[model samples]
Target: MIGRLNHVAIAVPDLDAACAQYASALGATVGAPQDEPDHGVTVVFIDLPNTKIEFLYPLGDDSPIKGFLEKNPSGGIHHICYEVDDIVAAREKLLAEGARVLGNGEPKIGAHGKPVLFLHPKDFNGCLIELEQV
Candidate 1:
């Protein structure tokens, strides 16, 4: 149902500041910030050898990340993404297993330009799970 870990998303209060910290301190390669209007976020990805780390912040008043940051001022890991061969099939299996899918239970194109779906955090041991079709 799940494959390799794709990337870990971190919600931050300041997107540029967070990217600067990673670029300066860790000397990591940080990609350009891309605004996702549909998702209501401005994000930047830090590329790594094995996986990427996404740093994102709210782009609008009703952004989900905004609420997350309100609850956690310092920001934190928002979700962990895992690769799936077939997102629709994986979603069906998960639903059959009593797992709750977030959003409209439909796969939306994610930051990586792949179909992705988010699962309820409570259903996955308090950790939000993102399934990205690989």
Candidate 2:
């Protein structure tokens, strides 16, 4: 049902600063940053061997990450995305198995330029899960 670790989203206060830090510390080149207004955040991706890391920051106070930051101040891992070959089938199978979906049955453009959907954490052992078709 799962493919690979697509990315690990880390909520940060400053996307640029976080990207720079990752670049300097891990010698990772940051990809172009993208603003996902629909999701209320912006992101910069750093590709790795088998997975990638996404630096996300709130676009405004209404952003979900903003609330996360309010709770932890210094933000942290927001969620983990797994690449899947068939999102619709996977989603349907998950739903049939009693997984709660965070959104309606629609795939939205994700930070990685792929169609994505979020599965409720309640269905994933308290770990927020993301499914991306890439």
Among these predictions, the greatest lDDT belongs to 1
TM-score of 1: 0.94
Pairs of residues at least 3 apart in sequence or in different chains that clash in candidate 1: none
Tally clashing residue pairs in candidate 1.
0
Cα displacement (Å) at residue 38, model 2: 2.8
Q: Which ten residues in a row have the lowest lDDT in candidate 2?
A: 104-113
Cα lDDT of model 2 overall? 0.84
Q: Per-candidate TM vs. native?
A: 0.94, 0.86
* Residue 127, candidate 2: C-alpha displacement in angstroms: 1.0
Off by over 4 Å in 2: none
The models' CA-based lDDT, in order, is 0.92, 0.84
Positional deviation of residue 3's Cα in model 1 after best superposition, in angstroms: 1.1
- Writing each residue's lDDT as its tens digit, candidate 2 over 1-134 gives 78888889898877777888888987997888888887788878888887888888888568878888788677788899998998889888987998887878788887656889999987788889999997
C-alpha-based local distance difference test score of model 1: 0.92
